[model samples]
Target: MTLALRLGKTLAELAGHQAPMTARELIFWMAFDQLSPISDRRSDVHAAQIATAVYQSQGAKVAFDDVLIDWSGEEEGVAEDDDALETLFAALSQS
Candidate 1:
């Protein structure tokens, strides 16, 4: 499979676990996986750039921060960071 396919799959799996992740968390995940160190501050700009490239490759029109999303899909205003996800998950789990 292509890199885009791999990334999409990974993203889907991640999204499946919970709501959308923040750019910072996504960056961290990418860097942690050794894809690229888009996790740092200076690296953030580059990370966004790379994510945009990946997004385009996947034919996804939305950028990283457009909404709350998981592997299944997206919801408006959902963040992509652990804190935000945790809060959302907590609320969701209670329901």
Candidate 2:
């Protein structure tokens, strides 16, 4: 099975329900896995970059701050790393 499918199944099992997972959630999980050592500032930035691309591609408006919150369980409205957000947008624009 594809990575997404596998992830969906895993997420379903974790949730104890077979509810469908959205592309955004799958992409977020994939990126999070690839960008481990999340406590490291650099890895967090990279994961946010990838997740931003995935969400934007789907026409979703997700902020880096929100991504950080979701990934790290950080409080909402916490300040985001501006440099990381800029880098993410720059990379996405180039693609």
Candidate 3:
């Protein structure tokens, strides 16, 4: 069993024991756990680890190549989407 598979299972169990969560709600929990990006560089690192764990727990057969970068081009798109979502949520919460 890979790490992602393990995390997926954990996440499923957590969901089963609680209400369904939105991405924003999940991110908020991450913040509550002191895992948000602003507090520490490790936060981002931890976030990726958490994501991988969730994938594994879910029984996905993901590999490094499956999750890792193919090229720098992929990063740009991902960063843009992440930034947009983060900004939107940040703004909404502030007001």
For model 3, state the Cα shift of residue 9 in Å. Answer: 42
Put down candidate 2 lDDT per residue, 57-78, tens digits, no spaces. Answer: 9999988765753545566676
* Candidate 2 clashing pairs, residues 3+ apart or interchain: none
CA lDDT, candidate 1, residue 7: 70
TM-score of 2: 0.33
Candidate 3 wrong stretches, greater than 4 Å? 1-39, 63-95
TM of each candidate vs. truth: 0.27, 0.33, 0.26
**Candidate 1 per-residue C-alpha lDDT over 1-95 given as tens digits, one digit per residue, 9 for 90 to 100:** 13434475445355566545568756656665564432244355556677788887989896765422233445567556898888999999999
Ranking by TM-score: 2, 1, 3
Ranking by lDDT: 2, 1, 3
Separately for all candidates shown, the number of backbone clashes (residues 3 or more apart, or on different chains) is 8, 0, 15
- Tens digits of per-residue lDDT, candidate 3, 1-95, equal 12323365434345565545568756665764563333345454566567777898999876534554344475543545787899999999999
Error of 1 at 79 (Å): 8.9
The top-ranked prediction according to TM-score is 2
Choose 1 or 3, whichever is better by TM-score: 1
Model 3: ten consecutive residues of lowest lDDT: 1-10
